[model samples]
Target: MLLLASVMAHYTWLAIDNLDDVSLQIQAEQIAENLQLTDGAPTLRLPENLQRAYDQSSGSYLYALIDSKRNILIASEDKARDVFSALSAEQLQRPESYFRLINGDGSGAPYYVLQKTLVGRPDLHVVVAQGHLHSDVYIDTLLTEFASHIGWTLPIILIGTLLFSVWTIRTSLRPIKDLSDRARMIRPETRGLRLPTSEVSDEMLPLIQAINTALDRFEKGFEVQRRFTANAAHELRTPLALLTARLDQLEESATAQQLASDIERMSRLVAQLLLVSRLENTTPNLEPGVDLNVVGETVVALMAPLAIAQNKAIALRRASAPVTVLAMHHQLEDAVRNLIENAISHTPPGTEVDVWIGEDGSLAVRDHGPGVPADLRERIFERFWRGRERSGGAGLGLAIVAETMRAHGGRVSVEDAHDGGAVFTLHLQLDKSAL
Candidate 1:
């Protein structure tokens, strides 16, 4: 708006200035047209309207007729005579000039003067002058009126345009915002999730469709991978069971016992692989809450025999009040079981592995062995990532635990215990309603 106003003002000034010059030129031409030679003397016989426009009493418009000798032949007023006669020969030779008469009865006011040679009477010239004060008053009044009527509305118009632009942008991009919100909900567990294109604008439709197509390919590939894992695990279970049974028939020697342990670890690995595939393929139900104390008790009881055989005891410390969390029952139990098994495997023979269920929806398993190094804490939860000690079991237990907690919107972390060893803690979202 400011630029528009500036441009308009500049052009308007040029037009007004040109109009002034054109007006002076027209008056001079009119006087020349009225020039008549009477007995070899040039006389200006202006019409009544022209006579009134150049009225002597007005003192705003004046004209003079001069001979080649610089003698004034006729003038509208005595001031016109003084204004034109005082001009230098160089100025009179020019077509147009400005003059400010400072002599008697001239008022010392500035005037724009035009000198034109009389047609067919080259020896005679007509000089016309208009007061600069009059033109200045006219220009100022016109500009003032324009500012009063039009200029003040520019700000209002600019503000209204800005508001309208903001509203238009927000309305146009509303669908994109909705699409962004829905895109955030896509996760590995959420299969067949795609962004909708019904509400999107034409400009954004292609991009959204491309993203959906990419998601389709990714989901298909993920499904293939998950199916492969599940099928392989299922196929291995039967052979592994048959092998275990065959080994059990003659497993009374130390070598046979060691083979049985290997078989057992292989079976555990296959089961965990199946569990991981299931976790990826299915979304766990989190409607009702699960009690951490109950899960801890059940898993501890199930693993008690193994812990005793290893000469390491397992202890569960339940919270005073029930600590309920939003999780699937089987998945929550699996996560707790993995933590307990990891603690038992790492703990020293004579020391006990402590399992604590806190009131804050936390399950902590503390061992009595060397703690996990700070550098490897985060990597320990990755699939197939074993510690430097390289425990005999496959490195899928902690990875499965991490995946379970992630699916349930929970997190698992490992920290140093008070006395020694690493404390693996699961922090889940508490079920306030259940509490």
Candidate 2:
């Protein structure tokens, strides 16, 4: 970075040098314009300031007039080969208009040579040479004094610029930094915690919103798990207690039959609640391309006995070809079984329950029972909203199915059966090529 600053300084110095040089050249041009070269008369009469300047200076000015043929018409010191005539003709008629003549006196001598027309002869030329050791000896002394001045000046300017740049960058990023700190301080225990939305940076606002959305989902999951766990423990406890009490009362030949049935029913309800909770928390990572046809076959085989106990017939209708989808095979099969069982439990004896697997990765279950009310259709998918008002099986069966479909980027809904029964539809995101 300092190197970059130096490059900038170099360009700045070039501009200063050019400006100063131009000013010096314009001053010399003005002096040349003012000098008059009259015929047979002296052209330049020195001004008061000029004469005073020459007197105080430790160096003298030498003037000479030379003709076109190289004959010297006039010389400043013609007395006896004075110090001014020391230069050869080649040196006098140099090619360049302005030249610095150095070491003409003794060691360290320097002079500035400017050519002008001689007085009294416009065709004749005169060369005026003046000593210049950096323009003035006194000026050279001031240059050293300014050395220490620049030594402090540049660093002070650099330090100030660096401080300002730091402040600017910090000010621009402060909002995001504060956001990061606040978010970091929050933990899982603080489920309702949120970032300060008002002080958010516009650039980071979308990211913050997305994080808050995720937090909302996490909080919802926490509440559901907490509720489901508490309710499941409470609902299962009484049946288990009854079964234990009934089993304990059974003497040598006494009936223990009711205890066995109660245990079985209680086990089923507990299993259903656990499955619902698992589905609700299922992440996309847990689901994959599982064959729906095979899953359906498995669930149907498992539930046929339960259907028979309810005096209902379980039917599976699927194409001969395989149907595949991205889904949790067991969870999806469990959901379908819940819907089928609920339908079978509600319908009269001998009524057929059909589970159809379509070629489009669609699963539909329909039962010949009184259909659900339109108003309660939405509530049917909600946990614990058993519309005993229609047909009820702990009311969590369809809710679990809906949650499973969501985890797999699929959907589940209830619609009117074409044959006048309640139909549950589960559509999964399937790779159509698998058909």
Write model 2 residue lDDT over 201-243, tens digit each, in one string.
7787788889889889988888877687858766787878777
Q: Per-residue alpha-carbon lDDT of model 1 for 213-304, expressed as tens digits? A: 99999999988988999999999999999999899789499999898988898899999999899888776678566888999999999988
lDDT of 1 at 303: 87
Candidate 2: C-alpha lDDT = 0.67
| Candidate 2 segments exceeding 4 Å error | 1-265, 286-289, 389-392, 432-435
* TM-score attained by model 2: 0.47
TM-score on alpha carbons, each prediction: 0.70, 0.47
What are the lDDT figures for the candidates, one per model? 0.83, 0.67
Worst ten-residue run, lDDT, model 1?
95-104
C-alpha lDDT of residue 337 in model 1: 87
Model 1: lDDT to the true structure: 0.83
Which run of 10 residues does model 2 get worst, by summed lDDT? 78-87
The collision pairs in model 1 are: none
